[model samples]
Structure formats: structure tokens, C-alpha cells
Target: MTKKHVHSVTVSTLSDPLPSVAAKTKKTHSVWREYVKSRYLFVMLLPVIIWYAIFAYGPIYGIQLAFKEFHILDGINGSPWVGMENFKYLFFQSPDFWLVMKNTVLLSLYHIVFGFPAPIILAILFNEIRYDLFKRIAQALTYLPHFLSWVVLSGIMFIILSPTTGVVNYVMAAFGLEPIYFLGDQNYFRFTLVISAIWKEIGWGTIIYLAALVSIDTQLYEAAIMDGANRWKQTLHITLPCLLPTIAIMFIFRVGGILDAGFDQVLNLYTPGVFSVGDIIDTFVYRMGISQMQFSLTTAMGLFKNVIAFALVLLTNYLVKRSGQEGLI
Candidate 1:
């Protein structure tokens, strides 16, 4: 009987590792089968998936240039590895790095504060306006800026804000004030970019919020009024609350694109004088990568921007989750 008991214990010990190994195999098989079952959907996504593979994922293999001395003929794989030499140069020796970073971050923050809320406010205001014709006209005028290429707008801006005889300067001269150099002044050029960006985009930006607002239940407003809630009260309690998710989503997207300060705007509007303030990472990349042939250095900067953007997206997603809003994650 004692021998039989020992033999049963030995059997139990022998089977212990098999359960875990079998469970792992089962899980892997199930996952693979599930993925195979979704093959039809993946086939439908083939074009976009292939496009991204070629355009997006394929380019990622070159990011090692940041750590190597890049060469055209050598390509990425054949390039001699230099470690963090490029990054060190950018941080310690590059004269423009700090100032450019400062300008980019400050301009981005300014846009977040003013540019982020402009559309939502405009949408809410437009929604509140009772007249139809005025609303349509206002919408058209605001939307027109978005369609106009920044090149045309920049030309118009240059004409209007030209220190020499531009219309805005003319008006200032007529009012007996000094002609302020709006575009040329490094101090004000970033601000000008942010304002112009809002002018061009506010209408289009509001469209999403407007759509969200339209989806709000009419009965809520009716019930609020029946409960003696005034227009302001109803807006505060019902309208604003209904719009929070949309706002949060918009905010997250804006945060994700913080480094993207409109390349066309900068290219068209900037001159040598304002390069101190306007030479952002994108513009810098264009100049260095395409113009100056420092492909590796510019690629490094671009990689840095994307990394920061990726982190910001994650951080914003985290904050959204904490706030109990629907999150990208």
C-alpha cells in the first residue's frame, strides 16, 4: 500500500509541467486560428497595409542613421556606426538647437492655449445664433481660408503686413503709430503663425464639434427648458457636457500633432530674419536633408519629433482615461 502511495505521488509530479506546456501551446494555436479567421478582413486592408509598409514601416529601418555617419552609396546597412555622435553634436555644439527647441515648444504651447479652444467656442457660438443666413455666411467666410493654399495666404499676409506701404502698416501710419514689422520681427512671427493657423482652420475644426452637437438629444434641451432652465443654464449643463468627449478627442489629436506647426506656412512666410524663431524641426529637416545633403542628421531630428509625438499621444491617452473619457488606447 505504501509503495502504491509513493507511485501516485510520483505520477502527480511528472504531470505538473505538462499542464503548463499544453496550456501555452493551446493559447498559441487559438491565437493563430483567430488571426487566420480574420484573414478576409485583412485581405480587404491589404492595399492600405501595403502602402503603409512601403511608406511608413519601410522607412523606419533608416533611423539608425542617427547613430552612424550616413552616406548615400553606403545606404543604412553599410554605413559605419558612429554611436550618438550626431545627437551629441545637436545637443552640445549646434548653435540653433536650443533656440529652435524653445521657439517650437513655446509656439506649440501658444497654439494649444488659443488655437485649441477657438473652434469649439466658435461652434458653440454659431450653434447659439438663431439666424440662418448670418450663420451660413459666417461659416463660408471662415471655411474659405482653409481652402486657400498657404502660398496665396502668405502672399496676402506679406502684402498686408509689409513694413513698407502694406495696408495694415498704412493704417498704423494713418493712426500715427510706428509700423510694426509683423513678419520680419522674430518676437512676433511665431505668434503670427499661430493666429494665421487658427484663421485658416477654425471653421473646419468646428465642423466636428458641430456634428457632435447636432447629435445631442433635443429632448434634453426641451426637458431642461420645461424644468425652468434658461438658455445659458441649459448650455452650461447639457450642451457643454455633451460636447466634452468631442473636445477631449480634439484635444488629444492636437496634442499628438504638437510638433507639426504647418510646414507650408513656415516655408512661405519665413525669411532669414525670422529663421531664429521659425526654423522648426520640419523646416530644419528640409533645409538640412534636401538642401544641405545632411540626410542622416535631418533624419535624426525627424525621428526625435516622431518619438516625442508618439509619447505625447500616449500621455494624452492616459490623461483621457484618468478623466473617464473614451481614450485612443
Candidate 2:
């Protein structure tokens, strides 16, 4: 070929993409087509996407306030950066910080110890129930409290747990015992919080475990029975093994939020008398940020809490996987 012709051929060859590039372009086109085909599903998901973008991810921008000396006149962007001063104050200077941390950790541990297994046991008991009517009624009764907001529930609790005129005290009186201040006394407040939390959430928590239970193969239980396994033995082997993955995932989530010790419940239920035991990080943050207007300080507190929570989630996930279980990675 002539020099110009050869040059033209070389130019054409150079202009065309290589095989890998062409394959990637083709894959992109295929994905675009799939997305177009699923446009209706995308439309259905748009609101949820918007909600997370707005409420969840959007607020992440304000996390910088944790490091700033935030002023009301000066917005978050206008605030002067403090370079971890707020965190220093939180760790060293704040007197209530350690107290609240202790309370939060203890309450969380209590929930994990007492509250976490409650739903699983309840769900297993529910599975054992042959009477559909009774099961449904029990479930409905347990679930009713979950539907009520903490404000309303606190009112109900106040009436139910009142020292003098309450039904509990009345029952105690029948046995010639002194009326107890469950809500007001610091000693009893934590116990009251744990019990009420369990009572409120146990049924709602069971829904997931119950759903997982449904997905377990009935034949496994039958096989266990054929092998001379009684009801308890069947649960021990068949039911529990089937429930392990779900339990691991749920436990990871629970541990991730170990710092969140029920703000609304504590806020509504606790008085100054029980502040030593019942106060938690959330409540402390609320008082600092909203009630007292220590926005920067509270922002730092929140950032600290979220960092610890994130670390806990990662650690828990790692441990779960190490234990040969499915985890929420």
C-alpha cells in the first residue's frame, strides 16, 4: 500500500477501541437497558431514596459542627473550626459525660441480656401453640403497647407504677408490703426501664424471628420427631439452628446501637431523682443541644457516639463471621 493509505489504515485502527473497552461499553449499554426496563420499580423506590437522601445522608453534612464552635448567628458553614476542642471538653471537662456513658452502657447491656432473648423465646413458644385463637390474642395484646408512643405509654406507666394509688402498690399493700417508687427511685428506675422496654418491644421484635421460623423446613422437625426428639429437643436442634443466621444479624444490629438507650422512653419516664441511673447519652445530648443550647458540645457527643457504634458494628460483624455465621456485612 502507498504511505498515505497505510497511514489512514493506522489512524482508523488507532481510533477504534480495544476489545476490553468495547466489552465495557457493551456492558454499560446492557445495564442501561436493564434499568430502563425496571423504570417502574425505580419510580416506586424514588420516595424512599429521596427520604434517605434528605433525612439520613443529608444530615451527615452537619457533622462538621462537631468540630466547630457553632454560633446561632453564624450558621454551621460560618462557624469557626475548633479542631477537637469540643471532644476534649467532652472527654475531660464534662462531669456528666462519664455518668451518662455508664448509664447508657449498663442499660444497653441489660437490654441485650434480658430483652434480646425474650422475643426469641416468645416466638418459639408461639410456634409451639396449637391454638390459633389464643396465639393471635396473645400476640395482639403484646403488640398493642408497641403501637403506643412513649409519651402515652409513660402516662400509662405513671398510673400503673404510681407508689400510692397504683395497682402494683395496691397489690403490695394486700401482702402488707411498703409501696415502692419504681419510677422515682434511682435503684428501681433502671429495672423499671428494662422491664417496660421489653414489654413494649418484645412482640414487635418477635415478628422477624417468627418470619424466620416460618421459613424453616417443617420436614426437619418431622425428621427430628421420627428420631425420637421431643418438642424441646426438636427446638434445640432444628428450630434454633435454623434461627441462628437471623439471630446473628439481629444481634449485630442490636450491638451497633448499643449507645442508643431509648431517648423518648427515658425522657418521658425519668425524673431528676433517677437521673443518675436512667440518664443516657441521647437524653444528655437532648438536654445539651435542645434544652441548654450547647449545640457544638452535643454535636461532638453525637459524633463520638456514632464512631463508637460504627466500630462496634464492624467488630461484631467480624466476630460473627469468625464464628462461622452469616453477618450483616
- Top candidate (TM-score): 2
lDDT of predicted model 1: 0.89
TM-score of 1: 0.83
All candidates: TM-score: 0.83, 0.91
Looking at model 1, the pairs that clash are none
How many backbone clashes are present in model 2?
0
The residue pairs found clashing in candidate 2 are none
In model 1, which runs have C-alpha deviations exceeding 4 angstroms? 1-50
Which prediction has the highest lDDT against the true structure? 2
Per-model tally of clashing residue pairs: 0, 0
The alpha-carbon deviation from the true structure for residue 246 of candidate 2, after best TM-score superposition, in angstroms, is: 0.7
lDDT (Cα, tens digit) per residue for candidate 2, span 30-72: 9999999999999999999999999999999999999999988
